[model samples]
Target: MTSTFLGMPTTAPRGVGHLRGDQSFPAAARRALADSQLRRNLGHATATIRAKSAAVIAEAPDWQQLRDAGAAIKADVMARLPELLEQLEAAVTAAGGTVHWAADAVEANRIVTELVAATGSDRVIKVKSMATQEIGLNEALEAAGITPVETDLAELIVQLGDDRPSHILVPAIHRNRAEIREIFLREMPGVDPALTDDPVALAAAARRYLRQTFLHTPVAVSGANFAVAETGTLVVVESEGNGRMCLTLPETLITVMGVEKVVPTWRDLEVFLQLLPRASTGERMNPYTSMWTGVSPGDGPQQVHLVLLDNGRSAVLADEVGRQALHCIRCSACLNVCPVYERTGGHAYGSVYPGPIGAVLSPQLTGVEENASLPYASSLCGACYDACPVKINIPELLVHLRAAHVTAQRRPTTESIAMAAAAYTMDHPALYAAAQRAARLTRLAGRRGRGLPPPLSGWTIGRDLPQPPPQTFREWWAER
Candidate 1:
């Protein structure tokens, strides 16, 4: 990551490299894989969303066309981002929208926290938003003595329980009904201790608890799904009405959005409106769709502040192999389908972002050094690529970032030396032939393969190695 963007530390101390080789995952995966509760929760949640998403796609005959249009439009915008952004600024300003550009996470956090404080309210209601999470907005607000009350059902569950969101679409996805019941019993003041694990009971508990926070909080914070620059409008698509309450009820509204969320025209929204819901929550249309522009004449939040955050976006935009990352609409479809994420969930990634998008996007935004392990976290199965509506090519990017990391490193470790030796052997026929012959000689002629003994135990840690083939490809080639 750049040292400072618009004058602030662009990356964390551990950095993106931490994610690349962060052996931290295996420990978490081992524990979570055995957690039958986590497995059941993920299986049920992803399956339901998958079926609902399929139904929506089936209903739209032009679904593929819309996806194609969305992809093409995003590519076009990325190509001419500077010019389009200038035009966007002009259009939004002309339409009475106030746009504040933030160069890094700290600046963005400062801007939003100050805006909330200006409302002169100590508490602010919040919609479930990734951008806010990306910048750690809630923590920043709290540090400034402004309490952010999460109003979305899942967000409320996470906040009340003092937990981090493990899934993008369902922030409380890791918690089953029983866990939620326990959290409510412990955290919610008026919650009845007799509450059961029924969905109805859980929702009622959350509603009653949030209603009080909603009716009183004078400020709200949110993240946008998309912004239409042509009309200077911001759109939020959500399944719950809590997002609407947080958006409309507050006197002053502060929205923290990534710079890449902007689309050039109003008509382009039609494509995303279809793509986001089905891909994200697996719905044809979210229950609450809210839109707002600059200051609405006494209708919504009287004073609106939109912070266009460019934290690490400009750097990602500069990279040729990694730029497609910003095309993500925060759908989390990639996460839902990711096998690695399925086991470890979001926390293992160690940032606001998790799963496939987190693997690549986090490193690019946070810098490759600190999160380097993130790129290696993938099996490069290409499942994320198949699931992406915008075609992010996540697996391919993972490899590219991995190569960059190794090449930039000063020391060559055992794995690096082995890779180099293999590359050299493959390139030189004589050396490969001699090595093959030696391996064949070492192999037992007519017995089950024995495990490699200690000192060489590294090769046998997981399984016994199969005997080498009797004849090398060179020997076969000679016979032919």
Candidate 2:
């Protein structure tokens, strides 16, 4: 028997990875909006992170310069991505690490599964990895009769609950203390019967459970935050020590990273290290910063392998305007400050990468026609752009992607016809004034603060339309 989501395969497809629900943004958002608990969880979590990020960012006087340097470094990386990736591959290989190139998700999963099989271990420990999630690696591993344990505390909570991540920095942000306590007691092995919802108790319980797995697991999988092309060093910036443990404890380590994660030099890495921590966790520096350059003789993992994934990234890089999105370091600052995301949450976007960044990236990765509503998910308030550390102009990109969606429509839509009609009317003064007179006659049939009918009703559902003025502004001006 195979599990599925909305009749589509649960695992990611061959080329571009698919969104979870397969439902459009509007449809999923309607469902998300009804979950009052989710709304409260997102609102509280986002507010706290937003405040923390702002305070720490204010402390750095050269923060803007750092942001500029980060953006410039990323831009240069993109410009020379092919060359840098080759350099990275050679460097990793020279450092005694094997490099594998996966053109798509299926290939990446196959390569990773085969590698784990060769190790003769059916169990592997994982560091927190968005790349693995994006490719649906856990499901793939499970199909091959291997168990991948999530070592990160939030990831462990999400795994135990059988839930998808709702936030970037905090995957289980949707679950409160009480909910987490229930998940731990129910799913975790050897959990105390009297476990409470207290934070310290939950941490202790999780630590004990994961400690056993960490010691036993012979294989570990991870994702890189940034891979330095110049030195072949892979960096994982984390708040918890789980990443460090996973990177060092296992005999074999396999890291799956997106192609866009590579930077040109170690100096370029310095700018991002400063930008990422403050933007993500609001700390001047992350608690654990793990770096490994391939294999070490008697130290960390003896067998190290890196899979470079290009699932929809090359396509995204081809677009001039859209490629700016690749500049994202995944700090998720935009998610913390978005008004729509606060209310609707990450699941509404239907992709692993959600919030404002998802709105732009998803549509471009999967054609705008497929995820048309995602681009319109925002209020265009420009909050995302303001909060972005790399200065991605998200609002401008949203409009651009929306235009692409309109262009892809096979036939003209009702909204398009209406907009065209209004444009034509406004262009001709005689027609505009005559239309205003016609609208004024509706004052007799219409009542103040009443809902409109049909096409206009949808707008009025949330807000009432004002009655048309008795006389036009032009008419009043002429009388004066």
Q: Which candidate has the highest TM-score of all?
A: 2
lDDT of 2 by residue, 1-480 (tens): 545443231222434444544787777888888999988988888999999999999999999999888888888888999999999999999999999998668888999999999999999999988888888889989999999999999999999999988778788988889899999989999999899999999998988889978988999999999999999999999976889889999999999998999999988877888899999999999999999998989999999999999777877788889889888888899999999999889888888889999899877766677678889889899999988888899999999998988888889976788799999999999999899888876675457766666765655544456788889988898899
Among the numbered candidates, top lDDT falls to 2
Off by over 4 Å in 1: 1-24, 437-480
* Local distance difference test values of all predictions, in order: 0.79, 0.87
What 10-residue stretch in candidate 1 is worst by lDDT? Answer: 12-21
**Candidate 2, position 298, lDDT:** 100
- Tens-digit lDDT track for model 1 on 236-289? 988768888988888888888888888998899888988888788777887889
- Candidate 2 C-alpha RMSD relative to the actual structure: 4.7
TM-score of 2: 0.93
